[model samples]
Target: MTVDRRGVLLAGTGGAFGLYSWAAGAAAPAPKRLKLRRRHGVRPKNILVVLTDDHRYDAMGFMKAQSFGDTPTLDRLAREGVHFRNAFVTTALCSPSRASIFTGLYAHQHRVVDNNHPIPPGLIYYPEYLRAAGYETALIGKWHMGVETDTPQPGFDRWVSFKGQGDYLPGPNGLNVDGAKVPQRGYITDELTDYALDWIGKRSGKRPWMLHLAHKAVHSEFIPAERHKGRYTNQTFRYPDSMRPKVPGRPMWVENQRNSWHGVGYPYHGTLDVGDYYKRYMETLLAVDEGLARIMDLLARRGELDDTLILYMGDNGFMFGEHGLIDKRAAYEESMRVPMLMRCPSLFGPGEVSQVVANIDVAPTMLAAAGLVAPDGLAGADMLPLARGEEAPWRTELIYEYYWERNFPQTPTVHALREDRYKYVHFHGIWDVDELYDLATDPNENNNLLARPGHEELAERMSAKLFRLLEETGGMQIPLSADAGERNELRDPKGPAQAPFPPRFFRPPGT
Candidate 1:
């Protein structure tokens, strides 16, 4: 293997070198290495991260029949780059998951465990780090980090986001562009993507630029782009067998439940009758797929497709009637597991699938793609080698955490350990009991083996692993006792709150 002074490889052992050389050489000349460098590394010329709200891993076409519809663009990404099969979020809640992705920390370390919680003023976002390291940065779409009134968004030179979850169409609280709330006249997905493309198209910065295009589509109240409204309307939706109404057996924690975003029984407020909920979800996802294709097209058009590092991920997994629940904030695979994909045509081999990765690793991975050193305090490791299909035995197990949702009391604050074949969920609340699954044998997580005599020891061992991970992750603040109900009462006097569902309004159709 040989690497030139320009860091361009002349030859190598693995087929990766040939692939990269062919691709990169076919593109524009190598970006000039700048003198504005750090001890750790130099900045990438361009970075594009695309994030979707509340999307499950199975929803992608690459995931293969995990859901009802196909995501051709996402599938293309997976075929052309790396896909982390075991990618998961630190917290399944939207804001906390997004925060962890940016900070490379767990929700406990970041302390923004819920939607209502504000990002601590001192916490540095990864984009801020990029800016400090001499990269131009921009954040676009769906900044649910805080309420809308808090303006002058942090960490980005350019900012475009909504108050919370903004309407799909134009309304009073439609969209905000750099502190200005503007009435967008088209579909929210297209508008956000257009703004992101505009930034990339018009960028005059000599330094590297990091563009974060976060989408609001595929969230609740599944509204699709107008053209997509009738696309999947005729398709038959397959409901998961787990969605059937049944008693999720007791210690009362599993069986006893309250109103939830995705709950069993009658009169779910947002429930639609004209179409199956899952079908609507698939329809909503169409817009995201289209948006991704557009972004790729823009990159190709600008001649930056090969050099730019492109990342695609979901904030957290959403439940499509899995475990008789909706939304996230549970340790179940359906809620906790998210889709993660990366494409860096210059450095990494393509079409690799990594089995172990977490959303917390995203920041470090981005920094590594830019050849920058991740901050010392981050808990996530740089996963570039893993993404490049390097055969290093990475993590065999991952830790999961979900703080008690102050508004929704049905789901408990839980922590779990997921090894290659086993999963153990320990409920840190009084209402619930522990859960253990041999994922290799029981992939659906139907049978809980915690109380079974044969699996008791395995459960204990997994619990110990979870504890060690908690310590490693600075999750000492997480209470170990099974007195979660009392803890909730003590922590939040006005407890068991429900998130406010933002109202939907209309916008003019796009060209």
Candidate 2:
């Protein structure tokens, strides 16, 4: 497992599906709507994406977190486009990273790995292959992968959302739209951008659309939008490097999460004040950066804003006090790195890419920005030709997972891999001692160089390249979803109201 393969695997696409052409097999099956096979874009462009919930990866303002709390439209979208600077989310919660960004697989091949885990009847939802290729797909807000029904599934033709982790408070559990629940009154990120500009003022723009929005902003009970409540209360938060308490080798399941329940030494049981929880998750990300400047002024007033591709991200990454943990299922690096960006100034220009993208490469880079095709095993990587600088065959090693939830049960069932500046991790049902982290001289992983004595052959060659990338991305099962029985813990807002919520994850004994 020295990580090298010629002709990067295809055919029944389990691994490097970055090689497309339906990864040598499965294709014909998306048309639950538009039915397209011809207009492979020399024209049909449009695609918005956004997605926020628990938005981390240094809560924007261009990776300068602390008092630099502001994201003028995601810092002018990272100074106008492309900042992939190592994005991630192989499964760092929130409906298995939004079902690995709408099914490019892996949450153990889309069994919807936990969080009301349902959708497993032979998955598929890269906007149903862009509404069967003629685009015009639309899934507006937080559709927490079939949990308590927002009811309007199968690949969009306009379907705003709600139910499960929604409610940035447009009047408690409202807006369902395409299936009509509607009630949405005030601020749930400005009424999902005023019902996405009233569905782009009733579009008849003929094809090319993909919307997706998905916000439920800055998760956790951190509701900001009272004009960003007490705005960053005179800042001051920084504290990361495994929030101290003797580091140099910290990993006894991160010292058994200091008394559990997502413990930053007693978090859920109270006391989380990382200076008022990073000032209400950076003031609930300034109304998701003013609803991305009102959807970039509604895509520059529908002139399609320099030929639409836009993106933004984060269905994962969020852990304030770091390994003392705050939220997000931890494989750590602040719970699976996130914040990605992308734009489309007539195809691709801006800067900062760094590679390592994830959340299964946003549904084959939104089915290759609407030109469609990525189907087969779809594990993900059409990062639009690595965000259009071209040259394919990317991914050097990245695999992360997190499965211990019966309501956080003190973090376990892990597996990590990062490669190039190392990372390793591996814990699964915990017996301890296996961590590596030389993120090139401890990039804030606080130096747990695994049994360091000259790093025992780099931790046995990254534990055989983390089980050969968990058998080339199928993640070798164990993602556990044999009807995870008594479910309902969508970060617990009394969804399944088990009355007084105690550990309750059940369903574990051989399912």
Candidate 3:
């Protein structure tokens, strides 16, 4: 089915995207237009995009993460530019989310559902659009789309990347600097920043430039730079409210997940210490902030800080013991909601934007900023109008999908729909019950309202909307490919794993 999401909302990361709407009645917000209206009908000449892995929506100091202080740089951006308080990624996984950001298409459209899949050779990445428009483009670090190679892809002129999850330490296999095997001497985060700075200083581009500075820090095995190793040792790290998933109304799957590979109870088959884990994760991010500062300083030195669009986001969010899960892909808010901030001082003034945005919007927004229109089938809208608080129809709901992954098989395939105040989750290939939450009241999503009598109609409405999105996006029908030798070949071998949520929400005979 062809999904007419132009005026609506639909997005997917691994397998599906979300559909969103306002809760019941929400007065339209005032337009927040920028002062610098596209110089000569073209965006600024320089654009710097920095992407991180596993950075959650509330992880920054400005968001008031409990006991997690000292993100002054990120907080400054929130203070100086537009803060997307409701940012999310449709599929909350690394490869798929990154691909969505590059192509402006959902995971199913671009066909990179999981970490192992590759984009088709002919697919055009937005970098190609920028490069074709005479902008010098470069990609530095962590380009793990498919088959993890450091060789250059379609878009960028200069490439600096490594194999899957490049080591935090400068190992024997250093960075692949534009196809040359260059040795590394410093921390990977700092080293990556050095390469990016060098390129920014030396690039021969009178006609604008775009830099994709993707970082490898703050992923698993959180490694902090030497200077920051013990920075937070004395501070107390606070745990999430839902860290202990002993609540009665919680669904069976959420309860069972605590003992799995990605569970807080048994993280990576070792001791799971939430406090220590939080500390290490926060420490690792310190270097990322320092790197951002250096980049901003570079832009300021070149007299382009205010004029350039500097966007920061995470590829996907990480689950920090929310729903008893410690990793992404569970259709929970912790796994999907990401940090997004954009600052171009001369163009956009400081303010907070409550409109929902996603990774898929990045490509189209960048293309539009460069005075180019997105391709025909792009699933996301250019966010310039929304960012400017201009009067354009913004997203009302978000649709999300996640195909089961072989590496982490505990979590089932999922489809979800979220709006201003509610979230509906449907599990595929699992016997567990579906979940419904009134996010306005239960922001932590601790209470499940699926079986409650009074909430049935609301579930029915949300479920119907979810399936409409599924049919339109070809979400349920899309097939995944994998290697037989790798033991990742997928064919549901059990009792035709039923869609846990009824097509139109209804109770069973017993209920």
My TM-score estimates for the predictions, one after another, are: 0.82, 0.34, 0.87
lDDT of each: 0.71, 0.71, 0.77
Model 1: per-residue Cα lDDT at residue 222: 87
Clashes of each: 3, 1, 19
How well does candidate 2 score on lDDT at residue 46?
Answer: 83
Looking at candidate 3, the ten consecutive residues that score lowest on lDDT are 1-10
- lDDT (Cα, tens digit) per residue for candidate 3, span 150-204: 7777678889999878999988788888789888788999999998899998855
- Could you tell me the TM-score of candidate 1? 0.82
| lDDT by residue (tens digit), candidate 1, 1-511 | 4322222223433322122233333433343232323435444748899999888888887666543587999998888888888788878888888888887887776666677655543456777767777788899887787434426565699988777788888877756678776787888988988898788888765778899988987887888888877666677766666665432432244433323333533214344432376677788888888888988898898778878888999999887666656667878888888888888788787766657688888887787766676666676788877876677657788888887755456677788888889998888755345888888887878777754457778888999988988876557565221221122222222322333211212235892
* Candidate 2 local lDDT, 361-393, one digit each (tens): 887777766775565556677887666687778
Sorted by TM-score (best first), the order is: 3, 1, 2
lDDT (Cα, 0-100) at 242 in candidate 2 = 69
Better of 2 and 3 by lDDT: 3
